[model samples]
Target: MPVTKLYIDKEVEDYSNVREFSSRIDLEGEIVDDQQVIFDIIQESSDPIQKAKEVIFLTRNKGAFIKKCPGTSIYTCCGYKILHIGTFCDMDCSYCILQTYFHPPIMQYFVNHIDMMTELDRIFEEKAIHRVGTGEFTDSLIWEKWTDIASKLVTKFSKQNNSILELKSKTVNIKKLENLNHNGKTILAWSMNTPHVIKEEEKDTTPLKARLRAAQKVESWGYKLAFHFDPMVFYDNCHEEYKDVVRQIFKNVSPENVAYISIGSFRFMPDLKQIIQKRFKESTLVYGEFIHGLDNKMRYFKPLRLKMYQAIVSEIKLLAPDVLVYFCMEDDEIWEKTFGFVPDKDEGLSKMLDKRVAKLCGLNKGLLI
Candidate 1:
């Protein structure tokens, strides 16, 4: 039986309101248990909530909120700032790094919202144009089936002006966000893939069609949208498959409504190859033409990456030329070859992304990056 461990800081125990929220989910086949572990370090700990933050809510082998984002690297790039909400995904994907990123992988969520909010408040107070998201470590909406967490985040972020919150996910669980006071400050983004990839590599994820349908619904509700084509798997007939995905996207939602679209070829840590071999033997993505990048990560050789990038960029430009398009973590040479410019030429990638997000969210200038 899968079990969910609930950790509550003594400070917010009375106001945590976790039980009230958990009761709303129709959980089945999992042995759910609740415990109150007294946190003594909150009194003098620089970030007492840090410890509570570490006591991740896990199911079996899954973990949550493992580490802060390490600085000084641009390869594992997402322009937005990260909000490390939880780790491990409930839905399994053959090429997922989380399987190896976390040992004995289990689904875990951090219940230490008080500390999280405290940290966020500090960042938000900077009033810099910043875009932040919580989907990096896990699928953002997977927990929506059982928790109203996204809704709460929407409600919280709606009150902030400087930062735009992006909730990226493969799931179409936007019900929690439908009626929230979003203020257009939250960008509901989706990590998209070709239907072929969805059907073959991604397991238990929302169908590609259903995901776009949901994006259309959200756009109709006056929310800015974003899409990601990360891990653009290279396979026979992959170009046609990906082109079809781009077409389907514009059919469902206008490019004008999109804030940005990110295109990244498949890349992974060298260690992840071993994990995929041991756990997901059927996945051929690991066996593709790859080379060790300067950052020591295994990525598609430059030519292959440029090929995929140019193809996707051309297709997306046809549909939405003005929408911001950028690669996930490619460096100067690849950026110039693919996008015609480099990050530093535009005051760095992070700043450029901050401006794009700020403009889309109607935030004041110079608020992030």
Candidate 2:
């Protein structure tokens, strides 16, 4: 195992629990890696864990576990749910929001599992059919190379009947998930992009074929699977590329085995354009026909967005019409234009998605539609 060298913020070192955790990790009198940089923001924080939670560092934040999702109201359009985990990613996607979303971007894991389970138990007791994911802020399975967090979560969530956990990632790290006692309460999701996008924009991610193969392995393991084609970047021959990807997915995994599929066009905050230019000069995704959205972020022109969504949805529908398909952070106009139905007409989008998820996983017993 490659040990993660954690740097305890000076201010947090005085806490008994923090001290104990540091001792367990052998933090004292250890030589720092020449490649690692020491971050001092934690030293200035009164509650180091809370501050550490917001900042991504190479250290483990041994603090309070679990957190509320910081999603905007628009998150409801895409089945918003609480993300107990914070920002941490190993793959380097050029257009990833985490580059700017987290200060001092580094991979940090919160090791306080007991408190997290307690909080989840309370949330699950509400019996509200909540949909929660660890992938929202981070690639859910990226940490598996270092920690068996997904296995722990899968085993823990297997016992809960009221909530479902979605582990979304672009890696083929399903080894940690094999032979787990999953009760169909967890969705092992994969975030996919066109082969061109994967080659150009995403770095250190598993190949699309490998990801689909892994999804098939999970399906064979009796686990529900999900797929997302988020940030569907538009380029020359994008339609053909995306269509090929859909075909590949259907060929590898049956639609019946897929619990849900989500599609979204490329959208980015204006500031990210400069960051991409500075860090990833070769990326052309920033050069698309973009306009400032209502949220003052740059997105595809409304018509282009609608066209891309329509095309991708049509392709997915052709392969798996019955699979639960939805958009991420889109509005009523876009929804109607693409799917021909407003989320409002049905119960809220979240409930509709949750119900579909329940039915797919055989958990819809008395589940509210």
Candidate 3:
């Protein structure tokens, strides 16, 4: 973490978790009644994005903690839920949609764990299979060094049987998660890409081998695992590179232990193009063959996306015939063209993933009724 300045929301200034987090960081913090003061300072910087990485804010979530994943009706959504724990990330990626998602993005960690847990309790009481993840808004495990949030959530979920908590990240911050009796309720996931993509696009993230090694360690500790190839870049020799990544995944961890694998091509909002041009000078990710998608985002041409998905899915099927592989925010055309069949519209992709979780995690009553 490159955090240098800490700001606390007046509402949570006296929170015990905030105090514990403050003590862990070697810096003095300022408590402000309003967040605009901190936002103003960051906006005045020459590089607001980089400046945001150097600051951390402690605050309370004034809204719902669990929200539906913002998926388009035109696309086949997985029916995933977002556990909004934070707002921004410490790492920098050239194709990150978050760069333009927030008006002025800043690293925020919500200290109101009670409110978050309340949301989880309601979900558990529903007794339906829900796939919730914290990585939707930010990297899930990035705050492990300063807080006990990971242990608390893992232990809390272990006692429940209806839902699964997916903590996705690009970091190898798993030392604190070791030896916990997670009881297969928490799935440790990683946002994976080829080594070339990691080196060229992702900044300040763990290497490919190191992340897989961390996955191997966690698998040895009796935790189910998941991997995602989201925002996959298009470049020369990219197909072979992605195939190698699939090979590396099964090589490091057992296929039977993998809960699921998700694949999606690189797509971005139009506003993010200028941000990448200004921030990442050498990036050619935005110069691909892009067309306006039905969701009003810039997506690769249909044929281009289909070619890549077919190649990658073929490799995954050949390697692990039984492992569950799904697409994230893709249309039925792509699904049918790649796998020869689209997931049933009535059940959608979410139920398919829930079935995989039940089989792998030993949850008997896993259907979403």
| lDDT to native, each model | 0.72, 0.73, 0.90
Better of 1 and 2 by lDDT: 2
**Better TM-score candidate (1, 3):** 3
Task: Please say which candidate is ahead in TM-score: 1 or 2.
Answer: 2
Instruction: State in Å the error of residue 70, model 1.
Output: 4.4
Candidate 2 C-alpha error for residue 351, in Å: 1.2
lDDT (Cα, tens digit) per residue for candidate 1, span 84-126: 7766676767777675565444345566676677777787788
TM-score to native of every candidate shown? 0.83, 0.85, 0.98
Candidate achieving higher lDDT, 1 or 3: 3
- With a 3 Å backbone cut-off (N, CA, C), the pairs that clash in candidate 3 are none
Candidate 3 lowest-lDDT run of ten: 360-369
Q: Cα RMSDs of all predictions?
A: 6.9, 5.4, 1.1
Stretches of candidate 1 exceeding 4 Å from the true structure? 1-16, 21-79, 345-347, 366-369
Q: Write model 3 residue lDDT over 165-202, tens digit each, in one string.
A: 89999999999899799999889999999999999999
Global local distance difference test of model 3: 0.90
TM-score of 2: 0.85
Candidate 1 RMSD to the correct structure? 6.9
